[model samples]
Target: MAKYSLYINSDCSLIIEFEEEISLELSRFILGAKLAIEKASLEGFVEAVPAYNSLLLIFEPKAFQVERLLQETKELLDKTKSLAPSQSTRHDIPVCYHESLAPDLAYVANHAGIPTEELIKLHSQAEYPVYMLGFLPGFLYLGNLNKALHCPRRENPRPRVDAGSVAIGGDQTGVYPIASPGGWHIIGKTPISMLDSSRQNPAIAKPLDTIIFKPISLEEFNQYDH
Candidate 1:
């Protein structure tokens, strides 16, 4: 394992960056690092945010000296590398690709030079990795989208994208956990509630988890909606 680079991102945060590319190994390492750091309960630790290839640690400057924190962080990283990778949960989320649910399905298929059915087949067949959670409370930035389904964000973003909208932007795909302005091309909608305030863990999926899209009929989606 290569040494991860650690640097102070801000007065109260430290960034631990790994390889520049996105891959399962890098995602695992990032999540693992986060788990390790949290388990260590370093002085003044606030939280650990995991990304595709990096982990950000937020701490209180008043509790520990920056120099000492850096040394301790490095030692933690070295020890974490030897520990087993964290286990990841797989989530099967149902989605409806009906015209009403997927307003841009036809356009996306045309843009990809494939039939609508083929595009849906490709999208649903592959499993995606939850690289990070951002943009919204429960929004998951999933990766490993099929190359054929890769498409750029809309030239003009929609002012409001409905929550549970499954979208593809550039090389990634994600669900809009809340209604918000977005530039990604919406391809489907899931009936599942991705974020629930009442739950202990609000987000259904976490970093390094596997997400598989299971296609459902419009009627089935309607039942779920009700």
Candidate 2:
């Protein structure tokens, strides 16, 4: 296990920073550290937010001494070596890649120098790791997109991108959890709802989860609406 830097961020939070690059190894460590910290049940521990290569530990200043918390956190981190990265849930999200839904399909295919069908195949074939969740309530920052399919975000941001819109920006890919303006290039639309405030767990996926995009016909997508 590599030594991670632990330091106070602002006045009430601690930041655990690992290697700067993004990799499965780093992600595993981050996840393990988060789980171990949660299990420790330290006082004033509000939540641990996992990112690609770090974990942000939020706590209440009044509930615990900072020095004591730091010592406890270091101890907990030492135990992370024994903690295996938790088994991540794989979600086969259904996406409609048809022309009507995938407005940028042609553009993306042209940019990749491949046929639209081939682009869809490459996009849907790989199982992406959920690196982090950000930008929106259920927006999943998925990683490891095919090199051939890598593309930059649109020069002009869309005024509004519909919910369930699967998009790619730079080397990362993600889904829009709600209708909002975005710069990512939309490749398809998933029928499955990724976020719902009414549900206990609003987001269907979380950090370290595996997401598999399954291409579905327009008819199949319509079935989800009923």
Per-residue alpha-carbon lDDT of model 1 for 108-193, expressed as tens digits? 99999999999899999998878789889999988889999999999999999999999999988889988899999999999998
Per-prediction TM-score to the true structure, in the order listed: 0.94, 0.94
Residue clash pairs of candidate 1? none
| Candidate number with greatest lDDT | 2
Task: List residue ranges in candidate 2 displaced over 4 A.
Answer: 82-86
Cα lDDT listed for each candidate: 0.86, 0.87
lDDT of 2 at 64: 52
- Whole-structure CA lDDT of model 2: 0.87
